[model samples]
Target chain A: MEDVKVFGLWSSPFTQRVIWALKLKGVSYEYYGEDLANKSNMLLKYNPIYKKVPVFVHNGKPLAESMVIVEYIEETWSQMPLLSQDAYERSNVRFWSKFIEDKSMQMMEFFVYDGERQERAIKETLETLRVIENQSGLNEKMFIGGNTIGLADIALGWVAHTLPVMEEIVGVKFITTDAFPNLHSWVKNFLEIPAVKNNLPPHELLVEYYREKRKVFLAMAFHHHHRH
Target chain B: MEDVKVFGLWSSPFTQRVIWALKLKGVSYEYYGEDLANKSNMLLKYNPIYKKVPVFVHNGKPLAESMVIVEYIEETWSQMPLLSQDAYERSNVRFWSKFIEDKSMQMMEFFVYDGERQERAIKETLETLRVIENQSGLNEKMFIGGNTIGLADIALGWVAHTLPVMEEIVGVKFITTDAFPNLHSWVKNFLEIPAVKNNLPPHELLVEYYREKRKVFLAMAFHHHHRH
Candidate 1:
């Protein structure tokens, strides 16, 4: 019996990335949902560095960082390959994975900020998306790595599900059929995958959660501005 | 004949990481020093997403992002193993590598800022180093992965060379013998490695370069402040 466990927050896109990867590989594991306000001691112990989820514990050895954990899963399980066989292709996938991971934090700024900052962040996010739409070759291919879903696809999988909730709350739709045809199609194809479609958090719940979260974030930003 | 070409700026630590890895593995390659102002068309073509240095091209296929390129080097050459044999250990090393890579840009802020911002960045950099010193288990182990130098070491190899130059320019030292004993010792061990020792950018040249670079960065920050 493989004693695999995942510690995660219910609404976090990072956590969802791990869960989707695990499901795609057909791995059965226990899920421990963590309360961000009062985090579990086990989660703390598992991931001391970030003290955030999702942390993957395999036979008591804990691994943090969702992408790193996903890579570990891919390496350990041979059932479903998450990376490409060709070295150059693998590097390409990894490059985009890193790109999206780095940008995701920056991209969230537009969702939580108001006024000029929000406008700047929105412009930057659109520019980043435009680059992806043009260069990722998602037009001809269903996924970042050819047709089959792979690491880069999984890394980017959240934009398909969570970005809609954020867009609804912010009153800005990023991936329209006209504006980002390739990205729009890619999102549709990504959501159609059984593993991804089945495992996503409820849309209504995500909208509610992000709505409150954005309030707190904007409040804090306002507070900081006043203090400064 | 294998065509392995690296397009890099001599002063970049990220580029040096790839250089050390390839040299350690005894791979012969051509080096193209890029003028950042007038970047080579090939460099621009290869890494269109980032349009940055340290682009490794092997047999016409380009790989960008230093860590991604290092992994590619490890996979392609299969010479001196940069990663561990165990799956779990590899993840741990990769976790630290990712952590350091993510924090590095923020860390550089200390060198380029003044007054309160510089102090804040310095404190954060120290806190990050403290975590590595206390928890990363460098005290007992020679490197991040047991005895042999691996990917994590290569990812962090910049501190041994570039960091000291930055420290000299900034008029502050981060890793002291008494403060970060293990890291200090590890720096000595890392420098003694022939592959690393041979490839390091000349110390005097680096110090001179960073001094001018710091002036430019500080001037840009002042310009932004004035504009605001």
Candidate 2:
């Protein structure tokens, strides 16, 4: 087998996605912890398009973008399949993955804004969550990709861990048992997976990191508003 | 062989993506043109989550999202392979496809905005184009997925056909011969493919439709500004 390497930031949910996928597949890879403030030359070279971490380099060839990398990993390593056997099932997984990827940033926007902007983000976030809660068939299945911990579940893994940290720091709760029971149960089931449980970053460290990041984000938002 | 059906809106680039992919693979399916004003029950039933068009149903299992459908088609019908054989190559294709999918709407913001917002959109559009032009490796390869028309090419197919129509309607051109030579060549090469050439919507009709759509978009923007 060729050598495998992962360039990742410690606190990134995207990085954790890749990490969990690798662990689930039982693929041994050399992990490089990147300081996001000063990205490594390898990270830049590997992912020149985004200049972001969570790049998986296998046998010298590099693959970037977390979901894409996860898919590639699934395809390359057949053991412990991340997607379904049926093409349509796989498409359903991909659909939810794309949906979450598009909305996840917007979901996070509430943490970095105040007043009307924050309210707008919160509403949008709830709207997105409602769609997932109602339409994602979470009540029927333990995971988004069926009974197994599959691709869509991995894509949504951030909500289980990272979102809670964000909620703690922001002092706002979006996912409550009464409001989104299906999604709440999903969070529990997803985190219970041994692969996900072992691979997550420590909670307190992530909260501290995001707390500082949120301060910077709010400051920038204020600066933009003042200028306007 | 199971029954195949496609629920799509004629004018949507996303619908065309699935159409082109199916055509390229020589998959026979019934195309149901959707009325956006009053969408069909099948469209709603098949794509309940988004209630969007370009829902492909095969053997009674429905799938939503254009790129996801394209991947399903590729996986189901192995002939006329839409992704590369190598895992790394496949990841590269997916990376570009995801990048284009994410940025295409942001790039379109220039079409409906005026004044400072329009200026910001134009700047963003140029920046996105520059990134694609410089780093997408289109100069050496015929398509972003490599020598063959693959998922990324189909994902970006709209830019070749729809973007020109949008530019004409908006009275602005972003991709010129000198500005994006590789991409320009790519457009020509992409259009020359029989599957794509034969499947595209009529150029004049697209321009007319987009012009009307832009009017509606601008009206909404005006309303938003006034309300805010």
Candidate 3:
């Protein structure tokens, strides 16, 4: 068997996505933690376009982008499928995944900045959650694509683990028992999965990491605002 | 056979992507041209979130987002396969497609505005082209995937057909034989396909449509800049 190598930053939720998918599929891989600020040549060569983390190297070839790698993992392993068998169902799953991937940043802007910008981001975040809640029937389905944790569930996985850390830091919570109840429960079902539960970065560690990162982010944001 | 319907604006290159894919795969579909300003209720219902086209309705169920719909078409039809058979190859195809889909709007910003903002957009757009030109293997391959026109090629289909019209309006050409010889040749290979060649809006019609659109966009840009 060829050695599978994953180049990622431990704290990146994006990197965590590939890890969860691989673990859920019961594949073995060696993880290499990269300092994103000082990227290794291997990481640079593997992912020159984005130079981002979660570059999956399998049997020498590398694939960049977390979700793209997740899809490759899904197709290659072909066990415990993340997407549905039916094409329409797969399209539906891909739609929600794409929605989450597209909106992930905008939905978390409140955690990154303060003031009116954060207020607008809060509204946008709620709308995103609302759309998902309406789409997912939490009463019937445990995960996004009925009973099992599928790709969309993985796509929204960070919302379960990271969103809370961000919410705690900012003192603003987007998901609650009253609003986004379906999505709220979906997060619970998502975390209970052994693969996900076991693979997550320690809660306190992520909080600490994001806390310091937030200060740097705020400084950068302030500088960017003033310059513009 | 159930009638396949596409709701889109004719001038929109996004709509043309679905059109090209269907035609390439030898699938029959009814085209419904919608006035984007006063969108049809069916269009709104089909694509509630984006409220944009090309919305693909196979029977009653609708799929929004041009590339998403293109993927759906490729999966369902499965004749003229738009992606490679190997998992890694498919991932590569999808990576580039996602890249194009994400950057499409930003790449076209220069065409929509003028002056300093447009200058910034122009720099961004060139960077995007440079990335693709380098990564795409355009020297060896006729299209993004291979010799055949696949999903990435379809994703970038607008660049061949629509970008020229935009260049004509702005008096700035992005892809040239001297600068992007590979992408330059790719545009030629892409347009040579009969499905793409015949499906594009007439040259004069597209130029006229975008000319009018550029005015509206500039006017809107002016208002937005002043309002801020």
Instruction: Identify the candidate with maximal DockQ.
Output: 1
TM-scores, chain B, all models = 0.98, 0.98, 0.97
Q: Give one digit per residue, the lDDT tens place, for model 2 in B136-176.
A: 88989998868889999999998899889988987889999
DockQ class, candidate 2: high
User: For residue B90, what is the lDDT in candidate 3?
Assistant: 96
- Please give me the DockQ of candidate 2 compared with the native complex: 0.84
**A73-173, model 3: which lDDT tens digit per residue?**
99999889998888877887888889999999898888878888888889989888888888655556888767898998999999999999999888888
Q: Interface RMSD computed for candidate 3 is what?
A: 0.7
Estimate the lDDT of model 2: 0.91
Model 1, TM vs. native: 0.99
lDDT by residue (B52-75, candidate 3, tens digit) is 989999978888888888999999
Order of quality (TM-score)? 1, 3, 2
lDDT of 1 by residue, B29-144 (tens): 99999999899999999998889999999999888999999999998888799888799999999998898898888878899998989999999999988877877779889887
Shift of residue B154 alpha carbon in model 2, Å: 0.3
Taking the true A–B contacts (Cα pairs closer than 8 Å), what share appears in each candidate? 0.94, 1.00, 0.69
Pairs clashing within candidate 1: none
A best-first ranking of the candidates according to their DockQ comes to 1, 2, 3
Who is ahead in TM-score, 2 or 3? Answer: 3
